[model samples]
Target: MRILFIGDIVGRSGRTALSSRLPGLITEWKLDLVVVNGENAAGGFGITEAIYNEFIDAGADAVTLGNHSWDQREALVFIERAPRLIRPLNYPAGTPGRGAAMIEAKNGARALVINAMARIFMDPLDDPFAAIDRELAACPLGEGADAIVVDFHGEATSEKQAMGCFCDGRASLVVGTHTHVPTADHRILPARTAFISDVGMTGDFDSVIGMNKDEPLNRFLRKIATSRFEPASGPATLCGLAVETDAKGLAGKVAPVRLGGGLEEARPGFWP
Candidate 1:
């Protein structure tokens, strides 16, 4: 099974690049499933129903969320109805939506997608480790589902790495998001799970993780708050990871997927 996982989609530019290039990429790579982190899809805040549908229409099989999952007030209700959308698994029990979802790919392959948020330098929530364990148990790797893909939406690289190692043999792929800067360490873990510290953002690289750099730089220089930060309007780069899982639901190979314009080097798939 070939899967493509895209990082945080920022604002208009990110969406534009995605809408224009994704269809071609999907067809060219012959992807079976595609998951995109859309927490920042709506003007760099939270995803909206319309934008969510747009991503799904643009080739994303499932859309994942992070800390900003509920930024838009409407999402509280919209998310409950959207089956392809997934929020952090560690959220409170009564949270509006689910943290994991199961979907059948075009080729009739079953995939279990999980979204989990890390607690380090993040909001205090249920233990992600425990939350993931419970979620994965609900959909045991190959028997309950054909493959498993986890989006470790987090901050600390160490925590993300630990989570990847934790789910190594259990999942087909364990990729990180939220950092918005693609790491160079994309490889198959010891247990055959495809792992990457951060899949990066699908936004303007000229700014600070998709936000305007001026405001952040000012805050650092003066040690005082000034204006609100906004998403960068410049050219955006679509960043993420791609993996090919074998018949047994273990990742056989992985690659960092970077494309379009912006500040960073874009690397496409190296395997068929």
Candidate 2:
């Protein structure tokens, strides 16, 4: 299975880049499944129904969310209707949308996509480890799911790394999001799961974590916020992690993808 997991879409810039590039990449890379983190697709807040639909139209098999999953009030309602949209699995019992989903890839293979939020330096949600364990147990990788992708959205690197290790041999890929910066540690773990601390944001790198430079810089220097933080207007770099899984649903190859905008282009050399 050739799977691609895109990082967070910050705002319009990020969305534009995705809309323009994803389809071509899908064909060029012969991707079987594509998952995008779209929590910040709407003005760096949360994704809307339209934006979510846009992502699906642009070849996204599944769209994942983070702590900002509920930032857009409409999400609470629309999420129930969008089966391909997944929120954090560790949310309280009554959370609106599902934390994981089993969707068929373009190649007709079944893939289990799970989105879970970490507790470190963030909301005190349910234990992510236990939550994911139950999900994976219910659907063993090779038997029930041909491919399993875990999107661990969090602030701390340690927590994300731990999640990757926890799901090491079970999942096809375990990539982190939320910090908005790509980490260089993209590699297949000992157990065969593709792991990366963070895949970075698919937005302009000219700003502070995808936001306008002024507001964040002002807030930091003056310790006061006089203006609202907005997404940068420049071109965006579509950042993500690509993995090729074996018949047993374990990653055989993993690589980072950074394209367009200010970042240098990176694509797996093994792919034709």
Candidate 3:
């Protein structure tokens, strides 16, 4: 099974990049499953119903979310109807929408896509580790689903790495998001699951974490809010991780994906 996990999409720039490239990548890479983080797909805040549907139409099998999952306000209502849109698993029990989704892959296989959020320096939600364990137990990699992908959204790299190690043998891939900067450490774990501390944001990298530079600079320098933080409208570089799993739903090959804008271009060399 070939899986591609795109990092957070930060606004028009990120959405534009996904729309322009994802369809072709599905055909070109022969991807069986695609999951993208869309917490910041709105005006640099939360995702909207339209953006969620756009991701689905663009061939994303499942769209994941993080702390900003409720920024748009409308997402709270629309997400209940969007089966493929998953929010953090460790959210309060009554939180709207689901944490995990069973998506039928393009190849007719089932992929269990889970979105989990860490607690370190983040919302004091339920235990993400225990939540992930429960999901993985209910749907064992090779038995319940052909593939298992976990998007651990967090602010701490250590916590992300811990989640990756915690789900090492149970999931097909464990990738991080929310940091908005691709890390150098992306490799298959000892148990065969692919792991990366941060998959980066699929938005313009020229600014401060996908936001326009001036405002952040102002706040940093003046220590006061002069204006709202807006999404950078420059050309974006789509960032993500590519993993090819084995027969037992364990990752066999992994690579980083970055294209356009500021970052150096990259694609899975194992694929065409």
Candidate that beats the other on TM-score, 1 or 3, i.e. the better one: 3
Question: Candidate 3 local accuracy as lDDT?
Answer: 0.95
TM-scores of the models, in the order given = 0.97, 0.99, 0.99
> lDDT of each prediction vs. the true structure?
0.90, 0.96, 0.95
Residue 110 of model 3, lDDT score = 92
Inter-residue clash pairs, candidate 3: none
How accurate locally is residue 75 in candidate 3, as Cα lDDT from 0 to 100? 93
Rate residue 177 of model 2 by lDDT.
Answer: 99
Q: What is the C-alpha lDDT profile of model 2 across 1-272, one tens digit per residue? A: 99999999999999999999999999999999999999999999999999999999999999999999999999999999999999999999998999999999999999999999999999999999999999999999999999999999999999999999999999999999999999999989999999999999999999999999999999999999998889998999999999999999999988899999999999888799
* lDDT of candidate model 1 versus the reference: 0.90
Ranking by lDDT: 2, 3, 1
| Tens-digit per-residue lDDT, 138-243, candidate 3 | 9999999999999999999999999999999999999999999999999999999999999999999989999999999999999999999999999999999999
Model 2 bad stretches (over 4 Å): none
Question: Per-residue CA lDDT of candidate 1, range 8-125, in tens?
Answer: 9999989998898899888888889999999999989999999999999999999999999999999999998899999999999899999999988867899999999999999998
* Highest lDDT scorer: 2
